[model samples]
Target: MGKLTATFLKEIILLARDRSGILVLFLMPAVLVVVVSLVQENVLKTAGETGIRVLFIDHDRQSTGQVIEELLSGSGAVEIVKDVDGHEIDEETARTLLAKGDFQFCIIIPKGVTDGVKKRVEQQITEALNAGNEAQNEPVPLPSLAVYFDPLVQGAFRASVVNVLHRVVLSMEMEMKARALSNMIPVRMNLILQEIMGPNLINVPVGIFPRMDSKWGSERLLDVKIEPASRGGVEELPTSVQQNVPAWALFGMFFIVVPLGGSLIREKQDGTMLRLLTLPVPHVTLLSGKVIAYVLVCTVQFSIILLVGRFVLPIWGMPVLEMGSSPAAIVLVVVSAALAAAGYGVMLGTIFRTYEQASMFGPVSVVIAAAVGGVMVPVYVMPEFMQKISNYSPLAWGLNALIDIFVRQGGIRSVLPEILYLLSFFAGAMLIAWGVFIRRGRTGG
Candidate 1:
């Protein structure tokens, strides 16, 4: 215990003296979390929170255009920009503005659209009512609405805008068709009454049919209920801070390998490792002390990120981070993650002989693991093969465990598998490191 404590203090003194290492461990993660979370929040808001400005050129200038404008404005997902300065936007100007990305998209309502749609719908409905007659009317083509989008717009956002426009147009068509059918039904029934009861008796009560619901096109009988899925049975709202904070913090934790591995290489190159081996203290104790010191640094680093997410980010207009109900679960996962990271560092230090080798490989390996682990992008959104492969990364285990707690409102029981995986990984890494150390002692490498 005494030797372990002394070794621990010695490592702390060494780390504090290395200002650059301290900065990398503490400052880098803080800056990364803040910048990334805010950027993501803003990007998400562009679709809904802040309305996207869309160019609207209504050549129809009739009921069709007016109804579309009213529906889009009511949706509040986008702002309709009809003109530039005081002049109305023509198709050419709208296209030019879209090319320049002045707006994400443009909507052009063709001239006489309302009349053309009404005529086509009434004609189609009339032919349907006159089915089985030898005289069939010619089909009338419906005029189309034109929409142009910027090349830079994302496919998902573009699809969303196009879908809204489709809904609006479909609603208008359905309403117009229903009204036309209502008006034509009485005329068609009067003709049937003349055929059945003769022209003089057409006004008889038998000619009248039941009144149809005029609001069938617009009135909704069934409504869709939206709710979030969560295991804890509480509705959970996903936020960028919840995702990026724990993700980048775990990233910073694994990054401990660079400094920790470099420390080991520095000790060996300067003969400090050789001198330490000659001491009465057990080699295990010395190694344990370094692990403990780095684990503490990892803990502090994670806490700083959490604080930034919970307090600092909210001031910058991001959602305040919500720590899960189980603080103990958070601590347990953080420690397990710290141990996993430290073990990997110890293994790298044991295998590599120079600071350059350790420094370069440590960061690159962590970054690769992080990428596979759903830190940069959610694993569920990745290709199926990548998602299956991500399960192998130790960083994936830590990140999944943290997300379960922070976002899913999970407890230790929920993250037990990940905790076990991380611990087993730590044991395996430490074993490999120990074997390499013993082999080096025997061969004097």
Candidate 2:
């Protein structure tokens, strides 16, 4: 037992003395966590704030053009560019701006919009009289008619234009009704018609106009707040650790196993294992002690990363303990990850006859594992085929179990299946390593 303890302490001291290993295990994961969180935040912001800039070309010099400009300006959602020194805006220029992504939408009021409004007003009044409706009845709501804005703009922008059209059309309809009634009445009754067309009638539609709700505009951007399930509180932004820590920790833990496996191969090549065999110490005991030492190293590395994530990334104040309600679930993730690292180290040590072979191949294994385990890219974003392949990687099992505990707030019972799969992978790798070791012993190599 004393010899095994000495061996464990020796391995720990050796790892601590290696500055390059310490940086790879600790500092790299910490920096990567910050970078990934910032990138994700920027992506979400861009997607939400993407808006169209529109140019308005008004050919009508009449009050109708002024009315149109006023209506457009009322909507804070749109930026209407006006009074360019150029002649009428041609379709060619509009298409060119749209192609260059300068303008997503455009509006054009042709020279005869006022004449069209007058004709539309007369037709509306004729229809109202023919229907035999009482004058007291509310005027029919006008259908919105857009001039030339792209239909593919954000829903808020489209609704803004529609709302402006409704106001303008309603105002024209009220004016036409007043004129029609004045014509029908005798000179003595003209006073009554003029009195009926008071401010109330002209402005009723404006007051009841269906303005676009700002809340509805936000909904189009999918602005949803994600919060810790425990507090029921909301977060304006995702927690930094939530967005960044997993990938870095996973990749770091993976690389840490390489030096462990390489060290074992070196000891075997130097005949150190043969010298140790002269003692009464069992091989399994030595192996288990080595694994425990590596676990301590990995745990210290992970703890540092977690500390940096909490302080540097500062993803909300939700305590790490609040990641999951069950303490056992957290323990299970750590144990499973440690077991997987041990199994991989043992397999690499047994497969290679020399330190050179292990060093050459161990990094390749780590890279492949990182890629398939959603460490390089999230599993959610991977292609379906690649996602399916990820299920076969042991790192994926460990990461999935951790994500279930941290992100989903799952309990031990919820993560049992993942734990089982990870244990199975560890057992399989260990068995292969044992087989290789026994074969080499029989060959006397």
lDDT of 1 by residue, 1-445 (tens): 9999999999999999989979977999999999999898987788677777889998889999999998888778878998899998998998888898887899989998988888898888888898958486777786999999999988989999998888877777777777878777877887787899876773745336665655687666789999988776878777888889999999999999988888888787888887888788876787899999999999999999999998899998899999889999999999999999999999999899989999899999999999999999889989999999999998899889888887788999999999999999999998898888777743334
Clashing pairs in 2: 240-315
Per TM-score, the best of the predicted structures is 1
Instruction: Note the residue pairs that clash in candidate 1.
Output: none
CA shift of 104, model 1, Å: 1.4
* Highest lDDT against the true fold, candidate: 1
What would the TM-scores of all predictions be?
Answer: 0.93, 0.60
- Candidate 2 C-alpha error for residue 109, in Å: 12
Q: Give Cα-based local distance difference scores for all models.
A: 0.88, 0.65
On the 0 to 100 scale, the lDDT of residue 316 in model 1 is 87
* Model 2 per-residue lDDT tens digits across residues 1-445: 8878977887878777998876766777667766776676554443433323467776666656676666556544455665335555566677666666666667776777676666555556555554654344445444333355544566755675566566655554554456544443333233444578864543233323333332332123345775555322322233435545655676666665578788777777777766776668766666667777877766666677667666755454332322545668867776777777777887888788777787778778888987888876778788999999998887787777777666666678888987888778778877887777667743434
